[model samples]
Target: METVLIEHFKKARRLFRILLVLALLCTVCIGIAYISIFLYAKIAGPPTLTVPQTAIFYSSNGKVLDELHNGQKRYWVPLESVSDNIKEATLAVEDKRFYDHNGFDIKRIGGAIVADIKAMSKVQGASTITQQYARNLFLEHDKTWTRKFQEALYTIRLEFNYDKDKIFEGYLNTIYYGHGAYGVEAASKTYFNKKAKDLTLSEASMLAGIPKGPTYYSPLLHEENAKERQRIILNLLVDQGKISQKEADKAFVTPLFYAKKAQDEANAKKQDASYFMSAALSQLTNELGITEAMIHSNGLRIYTTLDIDVQKKAEEAMNTVMNKDSDIQTAFVAMDPKTGAVKALIGGRDYKKSPFNRATQAVRQPGSTMKPFLYYAALADGFTESTAMQSEETTFTLDDGVSTYKPSNYNSYYANNPITLAQAIALSDNIYAVKTHLFIGEHRLVETAKSLGVSTPLKQVPSLALGTSPVRVIDMVNAYGIFANGGKEISPTFIKRIETAGGDMVYEAPQEKKQIVDKRLAFLTTHLMTGMFQKELNGYTTVTGKPILKYLSRDYAGKSGTTPTDSWMIGYTPQLVSGVWVGYDQGKQIERVEEKAYAKKMWALFMEDALEGKKKQAFKAPKGLVSVNINPETGDIATKSCSKKYKAYYLTGTQPTTYCRDKGVSEEKNQAPQKQKEQDGFFHRLRDWF
Candidate 1:
């Protein structure tokens, strides 16, 4: 019995010794692992922060229009520039115990752990503002034990390295707000179109509540959720003694102010001035080898050629006219003829619904709108306005004999009429135009259009006379601008200049001029086309109550055109050239002239508003041009008996050699004849016939 007892005791002693050795080994391994992790965390650098370039659009006068971004990227402003209310709200909501706690809040963390265990879910987070800043700036957003350990260590380093204000500023500037906004500066500007320094107490509280979960409490996406979060933040502010109970109560009742509607947001986004200035900035940035980071974080101050008032008016006109219960989409382009600077441009009604900028991207047949260019080309080709063309019905088969096309006038009744060159263009007789185009080879016409800055591909066909070829709105507007600029083709420019954030002028737009046609021909064509306003105005005023003709005090030229699908009205003064296009995006047929509302209404509104203060300027005729009276229908020397007389003007190079001889007729003869004379004339004609 004694021997068995001794054996049992020895076995128990051995087991106890083994258990003690295992415990010591486990402790040593854990200690080494922890030390290894600590060393790794110390050596590992922060993630490389990649900020995206915030796209800004500015009006011509340098007002911000819009800001665009693909992610939470924006211009970061300093803490001093941020409003005091926003700063206080941020401190109150993000870290109520921030000033009192060390790098780690032991009590809060302990309570959070207990609560998490009891709830069987992680609900509360005990990270201080300093810790959160350190984690966001220097650590990845992982919620593992290892990541938390690293965060705690970095928090200690951050609190030691940075003061409270510095830490708070960093937090305010680095935290992400919803809607692709980062930092208080960007959020304030995005929501209110103001800087961070301009935020009110309510606005500040609303902004501070967003960082808890940006998308979850986004004012744009979840307004009620955002309001709830704001209430919680206001209550916290009151509890933390940052604000009085009454203040909290008032703030809680305050309705959270959100950003404008989508349309207004789009307009607000335009204020950035970058979209119009991007081309120029790209050239400058490339020349300077500017990195992407500098472009985004530097908060660049760009000055552009955009006139803010003009752009606003243009946008308003386009929106008002295009949205009038019609399916038609409209585009408007305005440019300075002398400088070729595009002042205001609205590509489409809404870019979100349709990103295809009809002004820049679409290519369609210009219909009779192409007649001005054709006339200009003919004048350049030694054809005078008095030159007559055979307007008989005609058809032409392609040289390959695979296809045949016939051109007809808009009225479809002047097939056999002998129309003069001036009459052909003014009346937009397709047969006469086709015959004239045939007289001048297709290649020469193409060269003429190309010289005038029509960069689109032109099909060599008889239908080209009626604008069957696809042409972009920019090209068409610039082509018309040639006449306005006295035949000098100036490249259209959207940007005026580009500068760095340090106020360094990186690039300035250069003026480029090239004479595309004869100056005399340009002036002569402009003079002849000025009559179109009188003709088209009669049609427009009969439909709409507004008389656009009375608004044009000077001799301005304009033309209206419609294909089966698209309608266009391109007109110009001496200083400005505006082109408006209206049609369905899918190319539906325009029922009639009355139904063509988009282009005409948009054009009238834009012109009336754009030229408000500017003086009415007339188109100047070049040095050697003369206006003579000729027969209206025959386009020949006027006769005394001919009651209708039209002014026939000619350029120096293409003037009429035979001046119209006018028989001397008394003023009474020119006036209305007596009714008795008309009855006597009818009786005399009947007796002579018998």
Candidate 2:
């Protein structure tokens, strides 16, 4: 029995020696691998630690407008700017031996390995701050042997090159904290409405506990869970001797205020300026020769020309006046005429439902709004405001005589008599406009519109006089700005300046102004537009703007145009020019009378609110123009005997010299009207040909 026991003991000793040799060999292999990785990392140098950051947009009022990021909100700050409370709490919860370890915590790793071995699964992680940061910067969060091996190499690289504080700072800056926030600064601002450095002990602990399970410990979503985790972190800090028990207990019971709820409440019912931001971003990318991807990743600071008050007023007006149940879309744009800076822009009624920007994109017929340009062309081509045409329904043979063209006024109502240009404009007389178009040459109106900054293509057709060409709201608003700013054409500006995250200037919009039209003709045309609201110009029909007369508080020159499918109202004061278009997206005809009136009323309401606190400005008349009171019926100079007359402006040589002969007055009865000199003008040629 003793011999048998000795044989068994010898077998047991042999097995033990074999196992010991294998263990030593495994240890030596691991050591060599570790050394190899360390040397390789040292030769590879430090990795590029910089990550994509959030970009900020500022309004003209110096308020933050919005933030742009590549699907994650991240703001980087130095370690010195972080609060000590957060650092201690993060260390306590994530890695207690973070400062002592080279890159991995051996004790924690051993514990995790033992736990995994007992459970027969790799369910536990013992990543130090440096390791987690390396993974965050370099690898995806997948549980695999390959990922772990790569993570170990990067961790060693980071530990060997960067100091503890920098590693900690990078870790804190890149850590995910839920709610799209990827950094401590963003997390603090998201939860507490304050900077990371301003966070108190309670807030710091709350934010520090989120990186473990962002969704599970989100204070905005799971406050109780977050509080419990925060308490655990606080206790851990107490156990680590970083804070006293009393301070931990005090922080555990402190009340916290979160910005998420307040922000949600404020956003519950608000106009989103996403459309304007989209436009501004497009301008930025186009001007800088960069892509939008660069804007999201480069941390640019964009200063835009949006007026918060005006934008709000414009949205409020749209919301207040538009039909809630109807799917009819609307586009509105307001701009500073003097600078061509867009103050407010509403692309569509709702951005989420449809992101199509009608203000800048939609091309629809402008209807009678095109008349002003036609008249401007005429005035420049020797046709005075006193120029007269028969308003009766008439058919004219086209240039190809086989094709005859007939046009009718609104509701087929006309004077069936001679009407002056001033009266025709106030009434939107279609026959008179067509006659003038044919007489002045169709190409002349196109030239006038192009010179006034209308970029939309226009055809030299007779129907073009009645605004048959489709145009964008923004382009039309800019066209009117030429008249408002006294013939200085300008391109609309969205961004005032752009800078890098480090405050280096990237771009600045150069002020571009060119004199594209005669100042006197622009001023005169602007004055002509004002006649739409003049009651004295009422003839066969009330002025088109008569419906909005009660809403006017100050003088404004505007034109309202309507087609079967679209309605437009564009106008301007000396300081501001605005335009609105109301129509269905599918070009459905506006059947309701109230819907047809939406454009005019909305324009009046928005303009009133936008100009509420500003000083009223008058249209300054340029030099070499004559102002006179004229009779609307005769286009003759007005006298004391005329029943109705209004002040009109004209070029120096174009003012009428004959006085109107009223029914009761005989003083001017003997004065025959002076005939225009027979020159090679369009009217004389048309008369001779007919």
The best candidate in terms of lDDT:
2
lDDT of 1 by residue, 1-690 (tens): 999999999999999999999999999999998686556555653323333336454556556644435455576566798998888888777776777776667887898899899999998877788788778777789779998877777776666555677777777777888776778887887677678998887888888988899889888888889888888878887887788989978877777556657547665655322323444345336654545565555555545566777767877877776556776777778889888888877766666666567777789889878777777776666566666655666677766787887776555556364456655666566776775676566766677778878889998877777788888887888888888889887866765665643457765677877776788888877765665654421210121212356554555677677898998888788878889888888999988555575676677778877887888887767778867666544554465665456777765323333323442222222212354354345335433522
lDDT of 2 by residue, 1-690 (tens): 999999999999999999999999999999998788878988999988988888888888888888898678888888888888888889989988888989989999999999999999987889899999998899999989999999988998899999998999999999999999988998888888888889899999999999889999998889899999999999999888999999999998999988998878867754478889878877777765757776787778889899888999999898888889989999999999988899999999999899999999899999999999999998888777777778898998998878988988999998988788898999999998998899888899999889877888999999999899899999999999988999997878898888887789988877877788899999988998998988999998999989999998888998999999999999999989999999999999999998998999999999988888889988889889989888887777888888778788878756766677682232333222342342225456645643
What's each prediction's TM-score?
A: 0.69, 0.88
lDDT of each: 0.69, 0.88
Local error of candidate 2 at residue 566 (angstroms) = 1.7
Q: Which residue window of length 10 is worst by lDDT in model 2?
A: 663-672
| Model 1 TM-score, all chains together | 0.69
